[model samples]
Target chain A: MMRVAEGSYAIADAVRCCSPDVVSVYPITPQTHIVEHLSQFVANGELDCEYINVDSEFSSLSSLIGASAAGARTYTSTTSQGLALMFEVLYNASGMRLPIVMTTVNRALSAPLSIWNDQQDSFGVRDSGWIQLYAENVQEVMDLTPQLYRISEDPEILTPSMVCMDGYILTHVYEPVEFLDPELVKEILPPFSPVNVLDPEDPKTFGAFADPSWFTEFRYLQYKAQERALDLIGKVDKQFEETFGRGYGGLIDTYRTDDAEILLVSLGSIVGTIKDAVDELRKEGIKVGLVKIRSYRPFPVETLKEALKDASVVAVIEKDVSVGYQSALLTDIKGALYNTSIRVPISGFAAGLGGRDVAMKQIRKIVENASRVKDEGLELETEFEIFDVNPECL
Target chain B: MQESLFAPGHRACAGCGMPIVIKLVLDAAGPNTIVASSTGCLEVTSTPFPESSWKVPWIHSLFENPASVASGIEIAFKKFGRTDINLLVIAGDGSTFDIGIGSISGMFDRGHNITYICYDNEAYMNTGVQRSGSTPIYASTTTTPIGTQSPGNLVRKKDMPAIAVAHGASYVATASIAYPVDLRRKVKRSLEIKGPAYIQINAPCITGWSYADGDTIEQAKLVVETCICPLYEYVDGELVGVKKVRNKRPVEDYLKTQGRYKHLFRAEGGDVYIANIQAIADRNAEKFGLLD
Candidate 1:
């Protein structure tokens, strides 16, 4: 498990071994340890890169966007509010096809700040053009760091990839992680060679404005080109298997979905909890399973429908809410299956926002509630049903 | 890569002052440089692909990150075994002096061999002329509209050159399209330096300033000569050279040239505000060791 180590260093070490050339980051809570450790890496000459101590998180991504576009293997780690500040540059990073990798240690956005684990941080960034992958464990975080490069820099993909891990859960907690040798990383990722470079000798221009007349076409290229990258998500994941031995999914990862009547779906580190609960439910003769989606945008539609096609009840448990409408994943998942033949009823449940624990205890409760609703054959409340909503905590 | 780095047709407004400044900057930067563009009017107008006006390889990351992005480019080139290349970060005044100050400072502090150019159009011309850090006092931008009693802006122009110099920049200079040779010479000199350098050009946007398109080059010269924005350099934080106050013209001449500043003159004329502007220009001259 995470090399039998706990604390924030595993995330930092996983990143350090990747040998990022520049990390333009500003420290925000929970995320501070990751950058602080990386800063130490730069200070000790262990990581051969420039650690840009930016003034704000806004500047952090802005700086990373600069360095990454300049053809550097750039990395940044940020939590909730810091991420919001960098929001302005997030879309530009992906739109320009700079293969910048970011690790969003999930946390709740603040006013009355809670430096605890939550999914709101990463979930808020669902629309950013960067490819999004949720790590199920520290091991996945370690593997996914280098794997992101493969997915993002592929000639077909040439898009940004964000490897998201739960803040306190995976970012802080330790688990089994096989540190891939540096030589292996080199063999797999090599150095970043930007499809576009800012060279003075053979000068070029970038990031020029696109007004209304051509802005849609540019967006069309982004949306259409993004799908091509989704194809490379598979291509790169396959290549990742050849080099790293452990293979990650291009979109969705399933846990015993075949012949299962009740299927549980979760993202990030909570998947492990859901998996454990599924095992406990299986021992009791209940055919419960899991569908963990890694790549959220270019949301895993076809693969999801193909994987969870047979489940009688597909429980899409979400961490963050879309405020009023369907859970973000439910909307995307429904749309994914709208044109398809799969008629599995996706029971949407919202849980674990603002660091509220979606514990294995709660996961079992949600699954049971879904099963009971289906057995009754009535409309299970379509809007998100909180498993345990208490005003005392509020 | 070819001679026509700037294509003839662009979506720039008919009387846009940006193209002239860009042509001059690119000419100074020459064809071989790679550009790190901050999101701005220049980038938006010049690069509406499948038709790019760029002859050289240019990249637009975020609006306020060109300096940082240039740093990344410098690091990338050095790390990937590239040498003898120049990285130019071209951003608007709004991007440079305001939103991107921290990133620019970080780049300067890191001591990268990059040149950054802030095309000082005095305000945020891209997102519709809003007030910016570089917007002069008493100017009417969308954010800082002039009214009775109080003049538009109470604050003076931000001291960006002083800030860049404070950050251990090897070379810092002010240049305008009005002087191509000096701009080229400064670009060439700044090119030889092995650390971050700052060059802020006095580019006036006719669209925002309510001036004639053909007045673009002339107004730029006016900014330098009138001493409203004197062109000077500070090396190791010491005054090196001033862009010269050739027949130092009255601030009124420069002010009268643009509609944005027309309010500063008022219905019968705001003599008090005019005097205050004169004082700012005088302070600039003596502060930079310009005219005796």
Candidate 2:
């Protein structure tokens, strides 16, 4: 049934359908409503699960690590500072291969703090060995919730996943999301049958210290599991589509990219505005397109190369800057296309940072720059530009 | 003898008091228990990669998360309706009194049906005897080394059991590795309680304390007998039991056994610090009614 609901409620409903055995929560802005709805579900007896009101984001994720190790499907959500506090436990969760799922409501990090939409929070922990998926809108946020669990809990890819949605843009907005059918969700995501768990009948040691001789091999296994997730993420997304009849393209989604001379690449909800800009620019005879990267970690390198192969110039727009370098997604895309046969001028534009608006005009300017580089052979002045910055601010 | 749940062949130092405390606690907890250990001496020594001393399900996560982790397991088992199995957290004093205190406080405050046991070896033994919050006053540690203008650690041990009681834990107790029966009884009793329970055991570190390998139990006993580390119990924030000392021993008797306190005897004006320590023991004796 398609019903208009807040994005957080849609996500909580999707989580409910998946039947998590444990939900540990510590409230943070933009992520609070998700847990609040889940807590209500538990309170009214609609959801029979252990709802742990933990003390901090650290404890919340730590408890889920324990709960997930004990063979329970567990979950939690947090934004900027909360996600930063959970930095240590994030590595532990993936290192232990817990298959815990978290909704990383994306927001900008602290220091001159802002509680607004940005991908910096999720991108900051990009190398923590979690499968990171970005949603373009509220519907995608709802649809990706169960798929994250399905991918993370796969027997071959026993890694945790972060379903990142732009903070207030997707979390607080009202949208007509097609709620997942619990019966069909069960088909794709069965009851969590753990390969190993904390059971008295069958004892096992978890998170044991590895000496120098063995430590690298253990890390290698974790890396191999992440490598395995690149394929499993797409396969499970396909399975989700087969069962639910709606699917975002698994790793990377493309819009009018074929036979285009210029391609714009980005992630999260900003892709919506960029798509609108692309449509306007196309009417003006600018051969521009958009490649929405859904899965960021186990970064869709091969699929990205294939998508941007034929472009005359590729412009990357993102909400996070690596600060001293180009945007994170831009750097990854540059590295992906580095050794490949696809040789083109790639420019990066950092926009929408700290929830600053990435309007259609700014996106149009980025495409015009990329088109100028392609058509008139214009040389860029800097490595990347902060696209929306006012000249007076500097 | 039933086969010990904590198997041998791990790498704890000879006469290290932690293995004894772990063995006793696990023996009391039995096979129907899961353990969440913090990163400390016991976790590093007992489970190094491919080898684990635990015969029961055990997990060691971070330095200060064992209590929260144990809460997770306890509530998870509750969701499973498997109330027979016990959830136990075994951590070190560095984990309990210092870094892990917030997580522990949260665990107890939430009233999770779990028992947290802190093996207080007085310092951060795994990191080579750095002074921790549980380190006693005037005792020398790597972080509080004896030098000019410095006798030793200037701070008293943090009262973790009292803090536990303040959190409204159903049962809070302190034990020493010197008395196996007393420690085991407290472990079993804590498990029997309906809600959160806390037990701190003063397990002497053979290496960190620089004591003779064979003197761990003697040092443990002497600390209690001198009224420096009293054994007592609180039931729901009320003092219910105290382990009385029939004849109180001099504080020097306990201090002389460990090298950590050797500075109190050798350093100039060391007698003054020793007298201060004696005063601390006397205060503990009077407060706990240890002589009664």
lDDT of each: 0.78, 0.90
How does candidate 1 score on lDDT?
0.78
Error of 1 at A51 (Å): 4.1
What's the interface RMS deviation of candidate 1? 2.5
Identify the leading candidate in terms of DockQ. Answer: 2
For lDDT, the strongest prediction is 2
| Candidate 1 lDDT tens digits, A1-394 | 2267654677788788788887877878877888888888889988988676766777677666666766678888888888887786788877776788888888877766877777777778888887888888887787778878766776666777788888877766755567667777777776666666565545555676666787787667778767886676776677778887888676778887777898878788889889889888889888998989988877867788778788777778877777667577877887888887887777787788777877778888877777875575427444356547897976
lDDT of 2 by residue, A175-272 (tens): 78898889888888878989899999999999999889998997899889888888888888888889888878899999989879999999989999
| For model 1 chain B, the run of ten residues with the poorest summed lDDT | B1-10
**Residue-by-residue lDDT tens digits, candidate 2, B33-95:** 999999988888888889999999999889989998988888888889888998899999999
Q: Please tell me how candidate 1 rates in CAPRI terms.
A: medium
